[model samples]
Target: MKWLLQLVLTLSVTFCFTTAQNPEAAGRASSWIGGAEHEGALRALKWLEEAQDLGDGGGGWGSDAPRALLALQLSNCSWIPNAGMKAELAATKLELQIALLLWRHHEPPISPGRLAQYTLALGAMCKDPRDFHGHDLISLLLRHEPESDFEFAFVTLAVCNSGSHARKRHIRRLLDVTGDTDKHSADTLAMVVLALRCVAQEHRHRDLLRFVAPPALALAALQQADGSFGNLHTTALAMQALEGAGAIAWDRGAAMNLVLSSQAPDGSFGDTFTTTEVVLALQSRGLAQVSQCKCNKPRLPPSDTELGNFTFS
Candidate 1:
């Protein structure tokens, strides 16, 4: 009877652990749209789609392909008018741009941030970052000595998302950096939490949770009376990071209220970049889940008038 009880207890623990780790089980649907917050997210999605530059030799928004792609993927806006074709075309152009950049610089094809961004963007687009134009972007990102804490955190996220092993040294460095509360800003701490969370989820390393705790705490501490971490972009990032780390103590409701309050009449949070981050945060999407987003609904074709006048610029 004692042995049977222990077996049942162990199974219960296992089920709880699995459920906590699984995003779907945790009620984090990739493309959930209905509530006020979700409606705001949809508005931001439309703003981003319309903001895409469809002019000659242009297929990106805000001159940043990876960020734009990440935002689009998070929203799963393929069913929104002509967003599907726009995303595909933008992704292709971004891929070609990456290839050209690699061709030009053999010594070090791209900066760590740029390479990380590209890896993330490709992953979101369902493209393999490892074999992009015969260049191994993940390996290249690992080789660089990241110039800043932000760069290091970005690289770690990219590596983890690409299904590649994050180096222990990099993880250790990030842990060390995150411990110094005086030096890092809210954005940096938020990024560190996100990167560590990605590594923890991918490797199932429960040990990393302790290391992730300090940064997550610091990020929560940065929350102001209005629930913003100084600004819209950082607040949005913090919301996603804290949630991703499972830092359940933070006041998510207040933070979300602050975010929702900032949406413009056009559904954007100021610029393309800010709107992108806000949309992701509003949806509870972490970088790791960006590539996992899938739209199961049958795509509706855009009207001829919509396609013919798609150019925003």
Candidate 2:
């Protein structure tokens, strides 16, 4: 009886561990894109193909989604060119329908440049978007001066989300091609570093991780002892990098402790974006919520003053 019980327990533990790591459990269907067999990729591919449109590139409508889907299919190990080609047409049709719907809702057409970029990037996955030749156009659009840093973050996500090593490599090349890092604004550097770290994690690229550490560390040093940072978004980016590097000294509780001490009485974090961030940081390190801190009130809400400053644009 004891021997039989042991076997059952061992199997149970094994099953639980496997289930916990099941790639299917991730929120995004594409989360396991490269990690899964071609059959699984096909399911996601079919869904996106059925949902995309080829015509409406304005205001988020267009071939981009389908392009991403088709690219994932091509990247899958199970794809055969003939069958994949057939599926690609259906996907493009789906995207075009979606674009039409979007056009109906638009007050004015989206910018031509934006439309071209979205389509071309999508097209690179399979057929090219009309007029735009390749992902290069998308990269160019992402390079717009005002908010290139933030824009690139999304573009990297688009390519990386496709789960193609080639796409990831292309994104890396885009980063390398940008030689203007010397003129980057503080916000720009933070966004770029955020994208770099995100791509690194997606591909388990250790070299990229190392490359992003210096700027992350510099940002970390900029944090006051109180855990408040100069810029809320940049601070979030820095913390994300530190967490990824395993260099935040979280076990010692230095960073978490500093954040806790700085949280205001109202449960609202400091005037900047520090409150929720500090709470989340503490949680990541296995600490309780700030409201549950033994020294504080039972509950508190983040203040409007703090919230307003960081309100989503």
Off by over 4 Å in 1: 1-30, 53-62, 77-84, 106-109, 294-313
Residue-level lDDT of model 2, residues 201-277, one tens digit each, is: 65555456655655544455556665534454444444544555546442323443444444444443433223323
TM per model? Answer: 0.78, 0.37
| Poorly placed runs, candidate 2 (over 4 Å) | 1-105, 108-147, 158-187, 204-206, 246-258, 261-313
The CA lDDT at 295 in model 1 is: 30
Best by TM-score: 1
RMSD of each: 18.1, 21.2
lDDT of each: 0.70, 0.39
Model 1 residue 188 distance off true place after TM-score fit, in angstroms: 1.2
Best by lDDT: 1
Q: What lDDT tens digits, residue by residue, belong to model 1 across residues 1-313? A: 3533454455455434433431211112345634777888878877777677544444447466678777776665343223434445556556656665775654655678888888887776666787764567887887887878988898898887777767667777787866686689998898888888777676555667778888888788888988888789889888888876764578878888889989999898988888888887876455757545453312223335323432211
lDDT of 2 at 34: 32
